[model samples]
Target: MLLFDLDNTLFPFRQYWEEANRTTFTSSPLTNGLSYDAFLPLLKMFDEELWPLHVKEAITLNELRVERFIRTMHALGRSVNKEQSQHYFEAFMENLLSSITMDEELRDFLDKLQQSYTLAILTNGKEKEQWRKIIQLNLTSVIPFEHIFISEDIGYDKPDPRAFQHVLKTLNVEARSATYIGDSWTHDIQGSIGVGMNAIWITPRQASSINENLHLSRTIYDIEPCLFHLNRTTTIT
Candidate 1:
């Protein structure tokens, strides 16, 4: 069985997110009349400022999503109430959900992989939202929904060994027998390696995630090379 991350690894999430944000902010009444070109830079700036705070655990995830918009509005000289901000965020989610599109090449690779392996998605996110991606990307057609693991549903997030353990036990596979692939240095690579699973680190920059000289980390620039590597070595079931 193969374990995979959904966002950024399987698809380019930033592209989908940008498209959704443009549509949502343009259509929302709360924004008063800001065009996407004008609004996006502010949103990006706010998002960049909020992320470090989020990583530090200074605010909850809900606050991370809602407060950024509120702060952006305040920065623009428009004050927004929390409820209105939440409504705006929800609308953004709807737009994001609608914009989910699978990468054609990755989809084709997964289609071939499933013929000889049990493919499963092990990712972190809200259950409902993750399901929306699975449905939108047609992931469930290739890998059953039951095999999908979402942190919100499992009550454990990645980098936490418990999350990886749950997926291993559920899939009835040993840590050594399974393989994990994702974009994160901590959550995906370290977490899977801690549990003895082989991990493929996908990064756009292709820099060393752990050390300047990683002894055994399998780093790939994109999923294509990872697919090519896997195809050569895939153990037929």
Candidate 2:
């Protein structure tokens, strides 16, 4: 069985996320409540200072989305009322979904892998937005819909044992028989390993530092090469 992370694992999430954020700030009503000129600077502050704090505690992606908007508005001297915050958060998320782009090779690889294994997506994002991305990318055409698990739906994010356990239980697979592939060392690799599943670290960025714990599993820059090796080795086994 194969479990995959959605964002940076299958697509260049950071690149597309930055573009989406910019588009939201420019076009969405989320920025209308604040001083438009100061929104970008506030976003920078939220991304650099506030986000890192949340990430360390293994916050759910939905909470992060809401918190980022609330904090950004507060930093910009705007109101942070819960109702208004929710509105902007929804708008911001909708904008982000419209900006997703999948890696071209990912589709082909997933199609092949699906024929031999029970494939699933274990992603940490809002249910609506994550589903939107999956549909937009046509991932459902290859991957089963029931196998998609989003943090918002499960109320648990990666790096948390509960999330990995949920997937194992649902798939009826022992941890040893399942393999997790994701980009983040903290969330994807460390989290999956903690639950006793094999892990593959997809290091898209060249300058990323290796996590000492992931030294035994496969690491690759591209999905095609990793899939090729998995096919060959699993066949041999």
Candidate 3:
């Protein structure tokens, strides 16, 4: 079994999310030509106030983005009427969809991996946003649509064993037979390893430090090179 993480693993999350947020904020009438630096104070105020509500709901990144904007406007002493907030949220999401770009060589790597392993997506996020990213990135064409799993759909998020168990049960594979690839050490690596699944840390940004307990099978700076190595190793063995 081959499982993938959706956000920063298959697609670059930081670049896409930042660009999408900037576009959404600048395009909105709420900003009113305010510089991002000037507007940031309000955004921070909103985050401080609204983040607790999000944590209660397990706070998917997409939802947090919208909430941040909504609360920011409110913090600036501007009334974000329900209708306006809804409009901004929708527009923000649309911009996010437009910003998605798959990592280079990801499609070809998935194509090859799919032939030898049952491939699936294991992601933690709001169902709609995660699915939107999947579709926008054109991942549905590479991996089977039925194999995708979202935290919102399952009522549990990564770093939770139930999430991994859901995929294991769906694929009818033992934990030992499966391998998970992701960028997050806590969410993807530790989460999968906790459930006895092999975990590979895809550390493209060098953001995380290696943990001894996670038992990571490998680390790769990029997916294409890793896939090529895997193919060659499989052929040699």
The model with the greatest TM-score is 1
TM of each candidate vs. truth: 0.82, 0.73, 0.77
Tens-place lDDT digits, model 3, residues 145-213: 889999989988888999999999987888866777887888898888899776668764443324322
Clashes within 3 Å, all models in order: 0, 0, 0
Model 2 over residues 1-237: C-alpha lDDT tens digits?
A: 888898877767677767666666777664665565677667666666666767676664456666777887877766576677677666666777776655567688778777777889999976887888898888987888889999989989788899999998987888866778887889998899899776678763553224422322333334444444545444211
Candidate 1 structure lDDT: 0.77
lDDT of 1 at 140: 76
* lDDT at 48, model 2: 69
lDDT of each: 0.77, 0.72, 0.72
Once fitted onto the true fold, the runs of candidate 1 whose alpha carbons sit more than 4 angstroms away are: 35-38, 52-58, 101-105, 206-237
RMSD of 3: 4.4
In model 1, how large is the Cα lDDT of residue 45?
89
> Which residue pairs clash within candidate 3?
none
With candidate 2 superimposed using the best TM-score fit, by how many Å does residue 147's alpha carbon deviate from the native? 1.5
> Which of the numbered candidates is closest to the native, going by highest lDDT?
1
Question: Which candidate do you rate higher for lDDT, 1 or 3?
Answer: 1
